[model samples]
Target: MLNLLVIDGVLLFLVTITALAVIEMRNLFAVTMLTGVYSLLMAAVWTNMHAVDVAFTEAAVGAGISTILILGTLVHVGVKERRREKSLNLSALLIVTLTGGALIYGTLDMPAFGDPEAPVQTHRFQKLFDQNVGKVPVTDTHHVEAVAHGAEQHGGEQHGAHEDEFHGHVYNTVTSLLADYRSFDTMFETAVILSAGLSMIMLLRRRSDEEIEAATQRTERVDPDTIKTERMDPKTTQTVRVDSPPGSDSSGADKKLAAEIAEAVDSAEQIQHDAPEETDKGDQV
Candidate 1:
């Protein structure tokens, strides 16, 4: 009991100090690493308290991957926090008060810490370890019952029509579920570990020549003209004449249009000249 208290006190002390450091430290990289150490210490505490799975996740994700990725980002961009310390006003105090009140109201319904008679521990945790793997709750025990109803479900019966018994141990029913009943889940967990490894490799990875080529192929080719150039009227001619003198335009097409207009005017004038003058001479006769 004294040792347990000592352990708890030490953990609490570390947690408090780490929290303060996290809040006070201006260096984001240092804060991230500190957060990882905090998580590692928390995992240690959880393991000491006999919650193994939670500890494992904290070790892998919180301490290892999260820390690495965050620190990597800090290295790339910067190590400084974006904002300075906030000055607390009345609004801040009021909001804090409301939040504290709500938290207190929520806490009123919570069971006291370490109450052994709490429904969670006495029923859920103890029952899981005590129950038989054959008697898995809410499952079709048909196949399991048919083969090894009494004996442990391992070392017997081929699954999926293959020549081997279900590849699993029946020590814990959940493990039995993961390994045998849900072998895909075991594969999924292995896949998660594989993904983490792949992520680590990718985060630190260099692209191969083929990969680079493939990426280049995947990228869309952009037209320089189509990009953000100064918007100008495309119909307007780009070539500026060296001299502004008459008939000195560089484009013969412009001079040609003027000649066409002049020829049309001449044709109209000749048509008017050839027309006979109309008179009332027939009526006089």
Candidate 2:
């Protein structure tokens, strides 16, 4: 009993620490890992309490499937939480404190651990179970050795009798309760878990190849780094010449337009020189 208590205490302490670490953690990846660790610790605690079925469920669903789902969610949502200023919310703190106090108070009325006179053990359902299936036999090492010796002496006859005794009945009470007596509840629980898993798969499923290809096509075809844009300065003027293909002949009209443009430029330069000479002649007169 002391050993069980010690183990339970240790597991609970680990669970508490993990929970705190998860709450304090900003990184979603680390928090997801800590959550799985916390679930595993709780599963250990449940197994120590002899609730093996619950422990198995917790380990598989909480630690295994749940961790996988959270990881998938992180892929889409990113693994880092948005940074925000942390502030203590007094209302939330008050609510949590009150809820914890209420839970502790509720447990005060409950029976001690493994108490035979507890409501669960003394309940009508338990009486029915005992009457129908018989209480599970507790066998020690000496009892097991004696049974083995008897089985050897009697051979097939003893083996047949033992089989007949446990026929059509589950030896484990918890298994019997979940599998036989409360089968509908168990079935519904399984359905709920299945639905949840399917929903998660739907939500976290990757895009189809066609959708991915379409998205790729929508992106810019040209690389921004490879593109060069030349911006001309407003203060500078540049003349661009359009060169025809080497074998292409220039039209007569194009040649005539080019000659007229060159003649106009030359005339403008001659008038500038004649103005300077006329000004010098007027000064001499």
Could you say which candidate leads in TM-score?
2
RMSD of each: 21.9, 25.9
For model 1, the stretches where C-alpha displacement exceeds 4 angstroms are 85-97, 133-285
Write the residue-wise lDDT of candidate 1 on 54-145 in tens digits.
78888888899889888878878899876654743678689989999999999888878677787776754543444322333334445554
True-structure lDDT of candidate 1: 0.62
Instruction: Compute the lDDT of residue 189 as modeled in candidate 1.
Output: 89
lDDT of each: 0.62, 0.67
**TM values, all candidates:** 0.50, 0.57
**Decoy 2 TM-score against native:** 0.57
User: lDDT of model 1 at residue 186?
Assistant: 84
Task: List, residue by residue over 81-155, the lDDT tens digit for candidate 2.
Answer: 886745666888899999999999999989996799998877565434652533324443235444666645764
- Candidate 2 lDDT (Cα, 0 to 1): 0.67
Compute the lDDT of residue 208 as modeled in candidate 2.
Answer: 52
